[model samples]
Target: MLVKAFDKNIRQNKTTTINTNFVVIGGGTAGVCAAITAARQGTKTVLIQDRPVLGGNASSEVRLWILGATSHMGNNNRWSREGGVMDEILVENLYRNKEGNAVIFDTVLLEKVLEEENITLLLNTSVYDVKKSSDTKIESVQAFNSQNSTEYVIKSPIFCDASGDGIVAFKAGASFRMGAETKEEFGEQFAPDKSYGELLGHSMYFYSKNTNKPVKYVAPKYALKDITAIPRYKAIGKGDKGCRFWWFEYGGRHDTIHETEEIKYELWKVIYGVWDYIKNSGEFEDVDNMTLEWVGTVPGKRESRRFEGLYMMTQQDIIEQRQFDDAIAFGGWAIDLHPADGVYSELSGCTQWHSKGIYDIPYRSFVSKDIDNLFLAGRIISATHVAFGSTRVMATTGFCAQAVGMAASICVDKNLKPADLLEKGEIKNLQNELNKLGQSIPNVPINKSSNLINEATINASSILNLNQIPYNGDWFSLSISAAQMLPFKANQNYKFKVLVKAEETTTLQVDLRTSIKSKNYAPEVILETQNFNLEKGEQYIEISFSNPVPNNQYGFVTFLSNKHASLKTSNNRYTGVLSVFNGVNKAVSNNGKQTPPDNIGVDTFEFWTPHRRPDGQNIAMDISPAIEAFNADNIGNGFVRPYGTTNAWVANLNDKNPSLKIEWDSEKELSEIKLFLDPDYDHPLESTLMGHPEEVAPFCVRNYTITDLQGTILAKKEGNYQTINTWKFDSKIKTKGIIIEAEHPSVNVPASIFEIICS
Candidate 1:
């Protein structure tokens, strides 16, 4: 790949030619995201793009929406972090475009990457040739421009192919495939059962505007022909509508990336004639003066060279929802098929398949099936004709780019090749890091509604901090708005404390009602009633144990269908997956599959155990003080008194005494903390902190650990702890307070401590 050399006078600060850790080609949706990721990982990264601007189809040329994995199927649904940099784009769009839609989203995309200090983007450059010695690893890439050419001879420990086409992989001798393969190959339903000689053609998209005027009309000769002659084709828009996005057709199949100009030229002439035919016909009398808005010279190429990867995804993967240990990104687009001859037929030609939810894009599909260093992204990633139909969308491609970058970074950091990451011992870190950056390896639809706090319109999938801020839990109003509900049968209830102010408050009332319902499963309108509100102040309140229904059940427990009231096996929408967001657990799955108890509180949107009973004393939950210290206690320490010695709860650190002490050591610095119980949750006395048969334990546990006021430990005893022991902190320092949450023997406890510490 070639990038225009910097001007001779150009000198970036801290002039250091750091060894190139990663080399990413093709600055499209996937490429840019990959570059951003590698740079973010502190790697010396370079972004190579053949185009002048960033963004692939969503650029100034094609102009499409940057969809992320945030749009929910329900009314009160929330978004997730499935959108990495795209989230930043949406937030920027919300912040800048109060009206919401920005005409030139590409400029915004360019600005985002340019502002990042770690990334260096090279536009108006193309990859001409790559150099190699042993024929396995790339030594350096040589890029060129018309006027002058320069070779970036620096060693690239890792290489990523983010080009919309598998150009880099092709150059690096990576295996690849293209066109419709035999149905038996991937066992795709729509596949022709035999490999085809042709594949779908590319498109040059354009937009139009309707002025609602009157113009002399006349029907063209061909417009008079039978519309049903084409396969699955229709001539419905006899009038005017700005519906021209899919009104594209290709001329012939050749070099898509190179022949885009010629294809767009052919599409242009057809556009004028098609418009003339419409205006001349009496059918579109309502839209007389329909004018064209924008046209693209560079067409969005759908079908192109596909590089062979370790895992060539087939239609069966989508239908079966195959789960791989190295899953990375997800795709939700429908399987849209166009002819390779660039013709629109009504019968057996055009086909589409809507994905039930987000399907995982396996990690193997990203790297070459045979080549050592080559990795493919975008439309080039391995997918059967049918599977690619859905996986080739823009939002999905952007995430694929992020995965490519992450894998590249992993190779450089761990000193491994592309195949090694997948075939070698373990690449869990790469998978984990990619996931941390809004990528999914689950290959499942994401439902994060249960985990979000704020009602976001565009920004979806955000992490909810379990950390609570002091509040007077009065009025007791906590709501979860869902676009729809799911049918579930969880016998569990959430345990949380609400701090309420008692005086001047009376008449506690709570109401439950459905906001939306499905078409067939609407609630019976036998009686009419309204919901009631409670007083503004109450001392303490819980998710009512005595009340038959909790307010959250009305919304929290939504049916699969839009119907406000639907039952399981009612032909209702109980099969759609719903993701609830909670900081502790990133994802939970429920298809509204079963009917839950009428008395159960769906308010918490949680699953309960039958033995413990709903709202049971032993139930672990998120609780906070309802009232401020109006009349305080001078006690240095506070503890929750359990009913019996058999009902003990370990001290998960919340606030620590200045007099406590602790210590610990490990091979690597520990950033996160979690406890484990041994005997059983109900019996804390029999618990032990011993590593299982697994190769190694996660953290070093001490019999006692102490932290100063600043939250840093001063000392600790290395030993297995199993009791109601105060996992002490290093008390020698000073800061605020700390909490020592016991791990095992009790799995229900949630203890997370940060900040409050001593230097």
Candidate 2:
């Protein structure tokens, strides 16, 4: 509502009021992630950035890689792609234009916020003061932009300050501290022998390609007498001069930490001088032609303010890999420390690298010890210097953002505060929510292999490390009551199968759910089967879906539900039609190994479409008998159509039979079928349709001819003719896209074919 009015008196002009549910203070890495998370979870989130853009140091301003905890993969710790926002950005980088992690830091960061609809981003906005109710309870915040003298007020139930400096916490009277702590503070062994005020200096980095290109080496004007001989610690490998850490490169060591503005001013001179030395040395034919891509306006900050929280994360917690009930995220970055003294000083000592085992951060890291709703994210969370050294990375910060957002959601939904959820009972549900989004927390069963839901499948997962859990013999027991949420096709048939491999006699109880029902949908589950006890390897079973399958409604929109997450429709449509058991879509097919069945002592939920295949006379996905297990539901990203995928609908079935189903029309085509057997969660295989679609054209009689993705005749065969029979052919291919294309004989006129059969 815009009101056109004139103020009679300039001094009596009334200001406008702004309100939001979640007001995040800083717009750094964690702040962005937190705001995105909250918005994704259906919250009214507002992110206030004092700077022009969201990223603090890791943006165009600083130009730093968002490193997670170290990996044991190489010299550095492995990168965890399971992290959502961080992983999304990294994956997008892989897809976008990039030579070698040459990050387009700012644009990608902006895309993430824009993708989420619930978040409101504020740039060039600074939080100046806090309006607390009575005695330290913040009622609202006053923000002022220096560019414009006008000030604004922001009110919210929950707030997250992902600022590296604990900006909001300081303003809100929340307890916080800066600089390194004494050894006695947290009993950290890595603290300096005598705690000093010195901190890890910041870096004003610059990027250029082909640093190893032939160039004459001439020392800068300020270079020491024996600068080339100085010991250099390589932060980045592959023989680059800028890869060197320490020595402050061009600025004083203390310049990076205390006087950032001064350091920014000094770095330009140093970089130019270095380049001048190279140019004056007659390094190249065109020394003047060299290009400088970036000069960091935002200094790469290491240590800042550490806010006080209910539970201060410590190094002991990391060394022991301690599991907490409120676990929100994990980090394994080494504790890298730096010195405090200026250049040419031999007496500067700092701490780095605590232990080999990484650390687990609890939800307590987000909450301030003194504030009710204020949460801290990014490097300012309540972590000891050593532990902060690890969790401070951008990837780990994303996890905190995701976790704190869930907590904030709980606070809003349940009308509780951050402190209330920090206690034992309140945080369990929030942690569970984080686990589904792939947060690294203890006791959250990850990667469980389900043998009870599908036949021909081995319950296996890396997170579970199945090899360590001794196997048992005679694992092929027929299943009962195992639920599954798979892709179901209307009027199609499928077979569910599972094979349990155990070396010893063991009792395996797997809970499964092949169907979900709320106010709008009903149980479309025609079969919920399970099996028990097989050998240590391959098993076979099949459940058919030829009956009147269930297809209630493809899209259901619930506006009154929790946060109104589904956006397509309201009234979660319950179309009482049998799901197409057999259809012509890749995801509508019956079977192949996808996700490992969840049967880890009843703490996991997992399901997937039997390698869905979308092309054929009747593209169907089926498997053998269900592995004896537990509850299950539809496995999906929860959208009728999601980005980077085909338009499809997921179906859930519950029964003891290995039957799969799907729904499709003339949208695309019925050509080649595909089966994606994903053993590694990171990369799933795209192969022919379970070796069965290859041997049979789904639309063939007893005779069969198959084509590949390019419509090339890969195989041809002749046999008997039948209509009401089903045939099964096991797949044995070591490639992706296990396609089973229907061979069309161009030798004659175009022939119409439907209702494929093989038995």
TM-score of every candidate: 0.57, 0.56
* Over 4 Å off, model 1: 1-19, 68-81, 98-103, 146-155, 193-198, 209-244, 251-261, 278-290, 341-343, 347-350, 443-489, 492-759
Question: Which residue runs does candidate 2 get wrong by more than 4 Å?
Answer: 1-16, 75-79, 100-103, 146-150, 194-197, 209-258, 281-288, 342-354, 446-759
Instruction: Kindly give the number of clashing pairs for every candidate.
Output: 103, 149
User: Local error of candidate 1 at 236, Å?
Assistant: 6.4
Error of 2 at 314 (Å): 1.6
lDDT per residue for candidate 2 within 1-759, as digits (tens), equals 998687686663234467888888888778887888788779998888888776776566655555554321111121122354554454444334233233455676788888878887778888878877755467888777666655778888888887677667888888876666666787765564333333555565555444445434454455334323223312222223331322343322343334767765555555544445445544434544444445556666667678889888876776556778777776754454555442223433233343333346788877888988788888888977667766776666876788888888888888888888865487767765665444545434322221111211211110110011111212212221222232233433444333333444433432222233211111223333233433343433233333423442221100111111111101111111111111112221112111222421111111121122221011111233321111112212121111111112111221112122221221222222212110111111111011111222222223334443344543444542221122223452122111232222222111112112110
In order, the Cα lDDT scores of the candidates are 0.45, 0.46
